[model samples]
Target: MEMQGEERIAARRDIVWAALNDPEILRQCIPGCQSLELKSPTELSASVKIKIGPVSASFSGDVVLSNINAPESYTISGEGKGGIAGFAKGGADVILTEDGDDTILAYEAKAEIGGKLAQLGSRLVGSSAKKLAQQFFADFNAAVSAQAAANS
Candidate 1:
């Protein structure tokens, strides 16, 4: 599946960029995230629990950041294993552009599922993925905006 969207965050570009790279911020923002540990500047290990339709699973994975252009854009990718449930892998290309005192964050993402997850039907899986993405961005925006307000 593929998805793309943009969000206008009420924060400076630099602040938004920093938050994007912060594992703590990501762990807090990502839906169902249990833990996120930075293994390197460009790598992270994460565990997330999610429910799709009637399936519930905990996924453990390593996220990698590549094609990086600091404070501008990067490609983030990861794959997770969920034991009997299945596996999920995806990547997103994120771009941040300055919009006055705020920042415009845009992303294009693509994902694939195998095993039982793929058996759930595309319509259901796609809707769930879209909802999850939206929730993540909304939470991320709120966290960044709050932090910016606190600092200023």
Candidate 2:
């Protein structure tokens, strides 16, 4: 599955970029994210609990950041295992740009799944993945917006 969207943030580009790279903000915005830890400046580990149709499982994943330009753009990729439920791996390319006093955040991502989740059906996996991605982005946008408003 692939997902793409844009968010208009009421903050400076540098602030938005910093928040994007902040482990705490990422953890708070990711849906079902139980925990997120930064392994290094360029790496992070996350644990998430996800439910799709009748399957639910906890997944632990590692993410690596590359193609990075501080306070601008980067590419992040990760994969996770969910025991009997299945497995998932994906990556996203994110860009942050300044628009006058605001920030524009855009992302394009692609993901794949296999095992029980895939065996059940691709449609279910795709739909659920899309929904989860949308929800996560919505939460992230709201989070940044709220923080910017508060600071302003």
Candidate 3:
């Protein structure tokens, strides 16, 4: 499946960039993220629990950030294993553009699943993925906005 969208954050591009790289911020924003640990400057190990249709599983994954351009853009890729449920892998290209004191964050992402997850039908999986993506961004925006306000 493929997903893409844009959001305007009430914070500077630099701040938004920092938040993107922050493990704590990401853990808080990710829909089902239980933990996000920075393994390296551009690598993270994460655990997340999610439910899709009738499957609920806890997945452990590694995320790597590459093709980075500071305060501008980067490519994030990750894959996870969910035991009997299935496995999933995806990548996203994120771009951040400055809009006055705010930042415009855009992303294009592609994901694939196999095993039992693939058996759930595309409609169910796609809708679930979209909802999770929306929830992540909504939470992320709120967290960033709250932090920006606190800092000012």
Winning candidate number (lDDT): 1
Judging by TM-score, tell me the better candidate of 2 and 3. Answer: 3
Mind giving the per-residue lDDT tens digits that candidate 1 earns over 40-99? 999999999999999999999999999999999999999999999999999999999998
RMSD of each: 0.4, 1.1, 0.6
User: Model 3 — which ten-residue stretch has the worst lDDT?
Assistant: 133-142
Q: What is the lDDT, from 0 to 100, of the residue 19 in candidate 1? A: 98
lDDT values for all models: 0.97, 0.89, 0.94
Clash counts for the predictions, in order: 0, 0, 0
Q: Report the Cα lDDT for candidate 1.
A: 0.97
What's the lDDT for residue 109 in model 2?
94
Q: Pick the candidate with the highest TM-score.
A: 1
Decreasing TM-score order of the candidates: 1, 3, 2
lDDT string for model 3 (61-142, tens) is 8999999999899999999999998899999999999989989999999999998999999999999999998898889889
Instruction: Score residue 16 of candidate 3 by CA lDDT.
Output: 94
